[model samples]
Target: MKIAVIGTGGVGGYFGAKLAQAGNDVTFIARGQHLEAIRSNGLLVKSVNGDMHIPNAQVSDTITDITNADLVLTAVKAWQIKDIRNDIKQIIHEKSIVLPLQNGVMAADELAEVIPEKQVMGGLCRIFSLIEAPGVINHVGFKPEIVFGERNGVQTPEMEVLSQLFDNAGIACKASRDIEADVWKKFIFICTSALLAVTKTSYGELRELKETRQMMIALLNEIYAVSQKKGVKIKPDFIDKTIAVIDAVAYESTSSLTRDVWEGKPSEIDYQNGTVVKLAEKYGVDVPVNRFVYDCILPMELKARGKFNRQTS
Candidate 1:
């Protein structure tokens, strides 16, 4: 199948390379030095599974260059939804399944508002990928999974065909029945993890520090409450289960926001804690914990605009 990977960052770069390596007609839409490097050489995925290089790829920064795609994977950040959304109609085919692998519940809704004709499939991607450099993507660990389904869980030909393509690429993928539940479950963990470790400290520090550990628990609980209010059927004893997952891992696993803040990049607080806050006001569900997180990270918005207070020792 002909595929177009929009926003060739960590998620797009790694997954698109896999599909392309599997002999699919994959065109990566990218820009800047990264696009130049991919054009000169190819996209490189440095993963625990081993390095993968796709030489001689069809790539262009413009949407019209890669028009008529069979499947278009929307991999851009949530903040860029409005920026690149109008291009969807320019490139996407009628039969294409626009999979938004963004980390939030509003992905389908947000994209549907723009391109409702393009079949918007909700994808709750489970991967720990990070862009090591402009042309290099460092996929940490090996367990990368992509679960997607239509807004309604019908056995569509497009969904089935996409599943087979992923299988051909040797990726563990599936067509989920309740993708919203999956997204909510993943979002619960992510919101807690990101908010708890945003203070330039690792999860180990927060878990070891009694005060911060309690705060982490509080944050997790608040997210859980919001999830319940939003009518997402999380697993029973979900908090305990998630905490066990957290405890089983290395103590020093920090959040992406912490790393982004440290490296002076924009964080996804508005989509995360801000999501909960908006829902809290919508449902009249008091989420003090989520509200507190909103307050804590609101100051970081200035960081994106070169206005954050820098601490010096």
Candidate 2:
């Protein structure tokens, strides 16, 4: 399959590299030092599963020279979507499937606002990865799945073909029955973990401490409640299922948001916490825990952005 990855970051690079490794036509759209590295030294993937460097996959700074992508993964950060929309539309053909493997619920809608609605696919990619260096992608943890589907829940030829593509790429991919529920399930856990992790010093400490778990549950309940109020149907035993996952995960593990909070890199608080609050207001529900979680992260926003060294007005 012909695939275009909009970002060469961990999620984009790792998945794209795997797809390319499987002998699929994959183009990586990237720029700056990372782009230069990929262009010169090739793209690298380092993970427990395995690692390899793809020297043949095409890399470009602009989409003007790109075309005919069967699937385009819009893996750019949430904030970059609006800015990159024009170029995104410029590259891939109209019938190409565009999947936004981003956090939160509105990513597909956000892309549709720019791209044609018929081609936008609802996507959820959960991978613990980061750009270890300019040209290198580090895939950590256990989850390496990519789930996506049609907006109307009907399995189209494109979706079936997509499932085949992902499987061939060696990703634990699935075309879900209820894609929204799957997205929300992960979102609930992620938002909760990120919010609670900011309160304490470290993920290990939080998981070991009683208070951290309490805060985690409270914040999770608030987000869960808000999800229900918005009429986004969740699994019948979602709460139990989520709680079970929380208990099963390694205590030392934390969300990338919390990692950004500590390292002082820009976090996805605006989309994660802010989105929950917006839904709360829409549903007229009191979301004090979520509100508090959002408020607590305000000061850390700049810190999460790596702006601690610089002064702010």
User: Candidate 2: minimum summed lDDT over ten consecutive residues — where?
Assistant: 195-204
Measured against the true structure, the TM-scores of the candidates, in listed sequence, are 0.92, 0.92
lDDT of 2 by residue, 164-201 (tens): 88887788998987788778887887787465546754
Q: Residue 181's C-alpha lDDT in candidate 1?
A: 81
What's the true lDDT of residue 94 in model 2?
62
Q: What lDDT is obtained when candidate 1 is compared to the true structure?
A: 0.79
Give all candidate RMSDs, comma-separated.
3.2, 2.6
Candidate 2, residue 280: lDDT: 89
Which lDDT values do the candidates have, in the order given? Answer: 0.79, 0.80
- As for candidate 2, its clashing pairs are 264-303, 264-306, 265-304, 265-305, 266-304, 266-305
TM-score for candidate 2: 0.92
Error of 2 at 200 (Å): 3.9
